[model samples]
Target chain A: MQPFLPVYAPLSDQQIKHIEDMADQVLAEVGVILQDDPISHEAMAAVGARIESDKVFTKGDDLRALIAQAPRQFTWYGQSPECDVVIGEKPLYAPTYGPPVVETHDENRHQATMADYEALVLLCDRSELLGTTGSLLTIPHDVPEEARPIAMARAHLEHSKKPMCGSIISEQALRDVAHEVGTDPSKCHLMHMINTTPPLVIQPNPLRCLRAAVELGQGNMVASYMMMGATAPVSIMGALAQGLAEIMVGLALTQIYRPGAPVVGGLFATPFEMQQMGPMFGSPQSQLVQIAGAQLVRRLGVPCRGDGMLSSSKLNDAQAGYEGAITLAASQLCQADFILHSIGWSEFGRSYNFDKCLADEALILSSI
Target chain B: MQPFLPVYAPLSDQQIKHIEDMADQVLAEVGVILQDDPISHEAMAAVGARIESDKVFTKGDDLRALIAQAPRQFTWYGQSPECDVVIGEKPLYAPTYGPPVVETHDENRHQATMADYEALVLLCDRSELLGTTGSLLTIPHDVPEEARPIAMARAHLEHSKKPMCGSIISEQALRDVAHEVGTDPSKCHLMHMINTTPPLVIQPNPLRCLRAAVELGQGNMVASYMMMGATAPVSIMGALAQGLAEIMVGLALTQIYRPGAPVVGGLFATPFEMQQMGPMFGSPQSQLVQIAGAQLVRRLGVPCRGDGMLSSSKLNDAQAGYEGAITLAASQLCQADFILHSIGWSEFGRSYNFDKCLADEALILSSI
Candidate 1:
């Protein structure tokens, strides 16, 4: 029931040099592809990157050469030997737990109540997962906005001793959860999915939240979610490269604003539709992009995050299981440092089925 | 890429009635114990179970009722769709790709091979994976006389697929690799794991090999793999049922007798040393049992096989990643039709390493 952290190999001398060299190249020659985000444009300009409108191109050789020198392994600390989980150059790791949101048989996706959150926390507390506990579902949608964060924090405080991660939509919510859970900002591992501002841009609010987590010395997860066929390029490889470029820009800002912030390079890239709103379910391109992109990020010596068991279907049936298993396993096998949507997660992170949760737990036990 | 066959809901109302009746009884009386394997014996037996020893208990209700009731979701026909993938209430169908085998890396420990017979098939062809192809290392030395069967069938066949599963020596291997590939069999969809027999259980005969696979037909894949730790129980349940019981009783016999059969049970239970060896790698428990057990058998309904990544260390690192991820994910998620070691593969399937694989793949995909 305790957290399961894996120990990663220390970066080899070559790998360390690779990270430093890649950083320098990324900073100097390998500029990012920025769109209308004023902050991104300004940041690239300040860094002396060649900027032409929204597209920033750097010296190809410098970027590629530096990237080649990046590290392939890194270490992660845990409360105990048992808590340690390694990233880069190892197998996958399972996330602690996600709360069940939708009751299995429900028609309408209801809000996750305090009781639901509590039960999810209990399940997570009793699971052998990695660093952060997840916001299993849409928590208590009916509760007053002011009381939500506090109610959510109470569950973490009472049920678990593991290093938990979460999202607070507002600055006030962040502080409220912090106080209720008795967490030292320096020790909090904050995680959130930061999607690219579609149609070319990075929004300021997400950037602000990321910066706050960084300043607090909390773990920051910057996810570059790209729908393969929609707002982004149709090519998977292209999408992956673009996503990496965006996140790298974000990561650079983190270091510049708050150096040595515990930032994890995150990518939630998956296939999308130009028409119907549906998940492609185990898009190999998505899986490949995630894996390859994670490798690219780790080349910079930072941990990376990936999605697992994520599907658009809203049920705990075969499609959910198939999609969940493939995506989750890919993330885990690739040795991702941080994993979101690890357990009891279904309907594309919408609702949670108890049976699915049990099934996910059984998988976690069998896998991690 | 070929379309995956799916398991469909039962057609006959009579079958539906039977399944519903079974579900009711199971919910009320045959409550499943999601605990370590040993404790579930009495509960399983209580359902009018026939105990063929601790390792081989078959509750008549568990097998007969469930087998008929089990739907084939995403199952394969003679190169076509065998059934429809039931999204929620129906059983999931997955394919098996590779055979279990170990590869040696610089002579430190025997690691499972990624380019084994079964593994390559999954990757090379349109299989869903590129699994751990074969199952023994230095077999030329370990089983000089027994090498022909593996070489002739499994290795030769599995090399022709796209995605596939891997092999597991310990429970950890299952967990680690599952996390890496983005899914674990036990948790995600229809997957399998093969628990082998103790020191030198198989006699290396052809009939036995055929029988093992044939008997494992749409039944349980809980293979019997005796280990040294807590898996070493006081009775047959302690010894056999702990891990190896599923294969010996549930899978092998089913597969050996019924080719292309579908079964849903398996295990990789092994034992600690009672006589000479001190938990050696690729011990008879790791090799002979799985090879000669139920994995190779052909089931009429569907294939039953268990898989996991095999690693020597307890944490995530290059050794863990290459040893676990490439081997296991290659088979289970990437290819195998029916698989087991889809996740939690590390330290030879003992402990779970959460998110390590997520980060590691960041490095694995530089080539892509």
Candidate 2:
């Protein structure tokens, strides 16, 4: 069956051009801070970037040229050859990542266990909607912190033949995942998520992980999760520009590490609620940003990544469903290429619910 | 704020034209059955239609001309001037209609009472999302059948000031509602639902109600509830064509009864689940039909009506949220002029839940 085409575009050409110009200006003038990574600082300096304290400034044209080196589409292979997936043409669903707690149908919240993690990996394997067994379906508190990534990788290999995301906590964790999976990044079996800290900063650990992944020829989903009105500007355009600038720098570094590496660009920004001092999801502003962010990524000729089926609701109630549906629909209509956190999310990603995962899987498949 | 615009259209102009031609052919050749309604048969015959037994065969152009006489937009008045609603520009939301049972938050379901009916009206009045106190929020089984319309009208007048749908069970009921509301049809104070029984048939009661409403200068929402694969063809285009032909005949009859009477065109079709022997709501095919139906209605320059937040779930669970969100988003993106069943629907509209209604109201308002 043919994949669905996106017929809706929230931004006009003039608006898109304006955003692109603003993003470029931010990259050239107010460069991003590369904190606690002297290796990257020296490498960027060698490539004509100006280093001032932790900030690394580069010309917009130079970054664009580097971005141009990355392939627009790439094959992400699984352990089973039949499970190989394409990145650019159609949207692909991946299970939710990075939640530490589990909420069940009885409304009980408890720390997740390795058993829960394995069960989720098996669920993703069985799902018709989810194409990948995403990393960190939930944090298994029962497992030691250092051993969690290994356990998660082993679960993915045993339960699911689908391609999987690699660990991004540190350089060693990334290598550990690569070694466990036989470390053949040329086959593109492992992809890693590299998130930039908001307000134009890249943390040392994630930056090191990015370098490790690229050096090993693994693909990267380079992203920035900006909390609008807090870490980023309050205006949509301004926040978008800042996010694009930050991600562009990250994408450029990937190209510098490996000139033709596969990378999916992403910008996931939601407004920070002042009263709550936290981020809000599924708001209209966030939805608009998702669409506009896709347009920007498409302009760069690369596949885009976005959150799928997201919600801030604490329960798997009507709010979760409505909010999840809105975000999922937005990602699909906005032409997202890789949708992470596609199922089993609740309480603003604080908890993952088992029943909600099953229900969301049905929703996603029905939509297809 | 400006009402949302449809940035997406499911069908292209060529596809829309093909569907229009198919529908016209069905009207001219296949015709539609006006079962047990001599008034509609005679009125249609007066407009150069050929009546053979119960079927009225009319040329598509004649029906189109009659449909053209109805105004593109009209004011649906409330008791207070401040409550008046414009039907064609901004989208308007109305509560669910025709649920026979009420489900509370505690998961108890019982036959609705007059008190429950009044509470629903008050709820609609208090809701920021619901613009009208839709008719029959629940069936007040406690009230006598003959007096139900009067009771419903009284609830709307005393408990809420929002505009409402008039009774359509019989001509007397329609007139009784008019009298209770002191309705001036010339001002289109009362809007009535005129549903065509599926498989190209118009039931006697609804037909008579349509005639009474048109004669009194009141507005009509002419619609068809086709269950695809049962009452209509399984193909989306085929079902849409059949529904369009059915509604066009009804719209033409309204014009024939009283030329230029207010009428909103509607086509609500869902696929019949053959295995379950029931109709399925919020299917992708149904969503596609809705968007295409909107395009067809826009071609006729009249307002369109559709279900706002429809679901088939038994509870306000994840299924309910996802299904409701899909239909609601489809209706809004399709540029539906007036949305009924905007909240509180469950179990395929067999039951209305109070908590679901409240939650859906919050979802709708937040989206706006």
Best by TM-score: 2
What are the per-residue Cα lDDT tens digits for candidate 1 across A1-368?
Answer: 01211222223445434544554454344445454455656655665557776665554333333333322343333334464444444443344233335574444456667776776667666766535445434566666767776777666656765555545476566655545555455554444445555433566666666666656655556667777777557765456555665666666656655555566777666677547765464455566666566666666667777666665556654345445555665575456766766666665655676556666666555554
Quality class of the docking in candidate 1, CAPRI style: incorrect
User: What TM value does chain A in model 2 reach?
Assistant: 0.96
Cα lDDT tens digits for candidate 1, B265-345:
433444455564444322223322232222222121333343444545454442343344333333332223344433333
For model 2, how does the per-residue alpha-carbon lDDT over A52-84 read when each residue is reduced to its tens digit?
Answer: 998998887788888899888899988888998
User: How much of the true A–B contact set does each candidate keep?
Assistant: 0.00, 0.57
| Model number with the top DockQ | 2
Question: Model 2 chain A: which ten-residue window has the lowest total lDDT?
Answer: A1-10
Highest-scoring model, lDDT: 2
